[model samples]
Target: MIGVYISILILLAIIVYLYFTKRLSYLLKSKRKLLFKSLNKVEKWFLAGSLIATFTFSTLTNLVSSVIYELVSPNSNKEFLKIDEKQDTSIELISESNEKLDKLLKDASIDPRDIEQYLKNLPLKDGKEETNARIDEWYQARKISLEIKELLLVVTKVIFEQNEDLTNTITFLKSTGKTDFAGVLENIQKYFQEGDAEKIKQEYFSRKEKVEKENILILKQSIKSTEALFAFQQTVDLYKELILVEPTAENYFQTAYFLHKLKYFDEAANLYQKTLKIYRDLAQENPRAYLPNVAETLNNLADLHSDKNEFPQAQEKYEEALKIRRDLAEENPIAYLPDVATTLNNLAYLQNVKNEFSQAQEKCEEALEIRKKLAKENPKTYQSDVAMTLNNLAILHSEKNEFPQAQEKYEEALKIYRNLVQENPRTFLPDLAMTLSNLAILQNAKNEFPQAQEKYEEALKIYRNLAQENPRTYQPDVAMTLNNLAVLHWSKNEFPQAQEKYEEALKIQRDLAQENSRAYEIDYARMLIMGVKLFKKDKSNLKIAKGILERYQEVYSAQELLKLIRKLE
Candidate 1:
């Protein structure tokens, strides 16, 4: 009894110590700035190495460190978060402008030139369109015109050639629209008069580097997290220059895979083609080394062609790829099941797209059988891919107007996307929105208006928020949604709502057309025609419509106006 009691006491002490050390390390460590800073390179390395060697230690350490660091780091001088309010504001404004412009441009009812004029007049400072846009935003937000102008001068010098005039160089930045030429020219003259070239260079490069590094870091994180194939493709492209400087098959292949995933068929196809060529040259010397790569590339190329709507081309490529896959599967059945299933699905998708429904069905079923079997064998490894194949099959059914089947597939895909979004909203939200939009469009087509409307509204809300936040990408989509909503209203005979939405869309499009007078002018003419047709009976509105049309007719073809006017008459 005494010996047993002693043994129990020792065991209890060990358990208590293990718990405290492993789980409550945060309680022991000082949650202080000095302690954090004291974590030197060697300590960090050791921590990392130890974490890798002992997952439990690393996990606990990371958890404790993260909680403590976050709690304590708030007031620390080491947490240097230097944000330029001016740049943030500028980005926001550009995003707003792009959204507005996309709406106006989509319907082709507004005069592009007039829209351009409106954009030019929307209170901007001059440089390049992007520069002016940034300046305009910054000016409105921070009132730092002199500082911005100096920065622009330096940017022009650094990004362009020695002989390039700062004014002209800044004037030609057409990313947003035409630069305000007169305003940019004045700023340039002022910059030269100030005689602060060196200061300008230093400020410009610092900001530029800061912006570039910030974007690169964001992109790196995005690449790791994003499920959207196109976004991932873009992320890969942004890093392409950096990766190209240190080229390897892994980097190249990953980028190529991302491109392929995005349905950028031409680019993806080219990448795979190059990859295959490399494999082919090496195949003679090292058949074992290169065969797998060649096979994968062939399969990728086949899928690329399939996406491009080139059925025969896709078929040929898939068959060639399949021969290799089949041979591998025969030699190593267990190892090759996944690849074989993937090839089967790709071939099926191609056939489905080509309207070879029966063959496609068979291929999908085959792939499904393989995937299902694999998923059952190893749920964690194969479940996601199985679900993907299920969705593909659902897509095939959907194309055939097999609504029940398609809905089932969509439900599965939605579940997956929803879970993904929950885990990483920033990376997966866009995809969720896209899927919602697609499903909504289908529902609308099927006359499920309420469900469709709900889906569209939800998607529009997310897209609008995204566009407002990242105007570079989502703004145009928001405009499109607005236009789509207008059309929906118009179809329902909600004339007032339709007109309001259309006008809202037109406002955005007009802002975007600032650089292209001809484009905005065309759009303005179309809007005039629509306005005249819609409001001809209202005498008060007709007068303004006719007046606007007459002024716009000077820029557009007289014949188009006369035709519209004749309709009114």
Candidate 2:
């Protein structure tokens, strides 16, 4: 009996120790800055290393920075992801002069084939004359989004103009009959005119997301009547309004979401921050209610930062989002597991960027497993997700130099997308093209030049066909594929072939950049830079390459020109 009592006492003591130690470890992890280096590394320098002085300094710097970062952030170590955002300025779309708008209005309606095919698809009862007029009006509204989006900026400036001479601007707005943009402007004008701006903000802006979802849905419905022109401004103004509304996290998040879609990174970043700040507080108060939003906002903010190349911020946000989603998934796997997979896939991509291939592989595998399970449950909803994760995994494997695994993953993803395309050609066709292009890249990396060429040609063909139907959406893909093909040709020492591809790709990119610089300039510049690399060693060839970029000195902004020159050097 005494021996049994003694065993019970020891077991109780062990349990008590574990409970306290667990609590203590949590506190330490959150509060303390752990040393980054291994004792083995320190001991090697101490005992057997030759460059003690140099290695020691580097070691101390790492350690110091770790502690300093801990102090600076008061947050845990955040993983960094690559920024995917391009050089989109505050003003994304641009129109140099008011003349562009006048010319746009004067331009002929779109092709008769386009109008006829579109009308054939829709149920229309109007006579040919009325139908043609409607098409012309709709055509102009469509052109505003593509040909000269910056006209809206000018329109806004005109709307805000206090000066009495608003005749031409008014006439221009009135001319946009299909969009009813003038009437939309009048509503804004009347609202501003009627209300005290501060009072309007106090009442409207203070209203949180819960009360505004219905309004947001109504705004979406408004998208049909106003099209892209009015929808972009009105939706952005609704939940996303700045000076007129108070900072509502949902509102700001929604606003930032639209802005990000519009490639307004600078504006999006500020609004995302406002959303995050509020969401963080709300999450702290009610994790169950608001934590998902916190994770969502973090995910988007991380993506925004990633686009901007702010890797550190991206890492921190992705990790936090991953953690939150994991927790949420544990509580409700059906709802949150997909989110967990998405965050994991994101982290995997970032890890690949950081050259942590093993870590990336693990995350990709985990994401693949989760997505596969989800796809099994709801194949229609999650099949694409599975393919996406497989694609990401394939990239990770390629980065790790596991060629066979990469090839297998890529093929699996390609097969899935091919099958999907059979059911929904329009939606899945792009995915098919994307996977082909990626596989072609992998083939290039492996020096299977023939296979690479075949894949590139296939992707190029798809993109070319898609671009014919939707140039605004798919032309960039055409340029990208052409550039990649150029690189492949250059690798094969086919200088003439490479040069032809490069020039063709550059021409397409130039036209696209002119149409929408915010969307395409970085791509154009990057392709030019890549093309220049081909002639880096040959002085004569290099001069010609430099000439290609230099010819456009007048076209690019001073800042852009300088940056390109520096990059070239």
Candidate 3:
């Protein structure tokens, strides 16, 4: 193309030069008629030769350039030429389309946390117009991607149903056109026309199973990347589809596990029960093979029941798991004693919650003995367990008002936690904070005011920092510590200090209640009542406290607050 343009320009320049120099006019003069006529003929021949040479050179150069482009450029096709012509107007559109498609794929492949970050960092405008535009673009892109995926899925399904060779079909489609995914449907129609019945059925099932296996693998990847609730749900649905194809124990167990993580307790419990039944049958036939699985499922079921506060059911399942674990431990204590100890600890905690004090104490003692022995041999792993048991025992003692005994246990737990925290602050700081809080409560009960105040302050500092780091998880702990501090001040007859702490705690609880009333509203109401009692003689405080109580009158704690108000009146 460039060569042709250059040749045309050169020929024009030559003709202009001849005209400007009067050479053509001199040839056509009448002063020497014969000579002028001969010159005119010669001039005409020269002009003709120049035109032929220019035309021939331009054509030959352009042909050679076209041949080189075809040989060197990988995308040199008729479509490439068409696209090149439209590149200027369509470049941005093509780029945006590709970007949206990439985003859709990324959204499918990433976890919920990543999705949250993506959404959080998305650019925003001052008005709804830009936001609306972005949303519309996202929706359109998502819709298109989904439609394309669905089409592919349908094509795959049809090919499997017809018992055709998918590899062959894919190759054929590519041969037709590399980007011609739509051609898959046309290929499917051709396969249907060439189909045989019995052979096709056999091939269909074989190919279907292969494709199903591949899909299952992909679904597992999706599950690993799925952290958002909606993504988890979608993954669960995919698991269900896989189960429909092959209702294997692994499939059912995986689906139930995801449900449990999602906190779908009822559904998870049902699936776990089904899993247990399967494992029980398998274990009965081959105890050595599947008995361990039975025990594992029983433990999981117990934990699930415990989370739902179905303590009786939880205890029953725990005991069954404990029995199996005990038998297993007797055969190989080195391998299974840890499981035994963990189950005993779990059972002990549930017993304590149920106020079966003697039974809880016995279980805790057994767990503590096992953990102590394990820690003696392997403190790196079992020392934390020992500390945990000591803490639980301390809580039981505190509840029973055995102040000295509770104090002894709390001191032991706190010592271990302090050492652990020194080694790994991120892991053990919360434990240290909790133990300090418990010790402070025990100290207050013993009327050791100065000691209790110091402990409370220490715990309060830790809780404040933790809440600052992750308010969603630790804010409630901060509120609890503030309330404890307020009680300590009240015990010491420091009314102003007590009131200040109570107000701070109440504000936090109120903020929390806005998000989850069932969890925090009772605390808010109780704090209001404490405020009322602290300032019963002040008209302003009483009025404010009464207003807060009246506002939350529907709360369970409101009745107690109302009684305090009535006595004050």
TM-score of each: 0.42, 0.54, 0.61
lDDT of 2 by residue, 385-463 (tens): 9999899898888777898999999999999999999998766888899999999999998899999999999999998
Q: List candidate 1 segments past 4 Å from native.
A: 1-289, 300-311, 330-338, 341-395, 506-569
> Which candidate has the highest lDDT of all?
3
List the candidate numbers ranked by lDDT, top first. Answer: 3, 2, 1
Q: What TM-score should be assigned to candidate 2?
A: 0.54
Evaluate model 1: give its lDDT: 0.56
Tens-place lDDT digits, model 1, residues 1-569 = 33344445555554465355453344246444554455579755754554354545445656777778778765322211222232233223323343444333332233222332223332322424554565456556754333233333333332222113333433433322423323333343343323323322233223333445333322232232121111232344443543344344544555566556445566666667667777788877987677777787788677677677677988998877777777888878788878889888888877876789878978888888888898788866665666667667776777778887777776776777677767667656776776676677667667776787787788889987766544545655665566666656666678898788767766665564454554444554455455445533344444444554566665436457656666666
Task: Give candidate 2's error at residue 470 in angstroms.
Answer: 2.3
Candidate 3 per-residue lDDT, tens place, 1-569, comes to 88778788878875585667565455456444543454567676776678788888888999999899877975425533433333222322322332343433332332332332333322321223443454456546663233233222332233233223334434543654643332433333333333312222223333344444333333332232222112344455655655676565655666666677567899889878988999999988998778777887889899999999899999999999999999988888888899999999999999998999879888988998999999999998998899999999988888877788889988998999999998987568778999999999899989999999999999999988866544655788889999999989998999889888887888898899888775666666666666666645344555556666677777656767777768876
Model 1's TM-score against the true structure = 0.42
Clashes of each: 23, 7, 0
- Give each model's whole-structure lDDT: 0.56, 0.63, 0.67
- Best TM-score among the predictions, by candidate number: 3
Candidate 3 accuracy as TM-score:
0.61
Worst 10 contiguous positions by lDDT, candidate 2: 79-88
Deviation (Å) of 411 in candidate 3 = 0.6
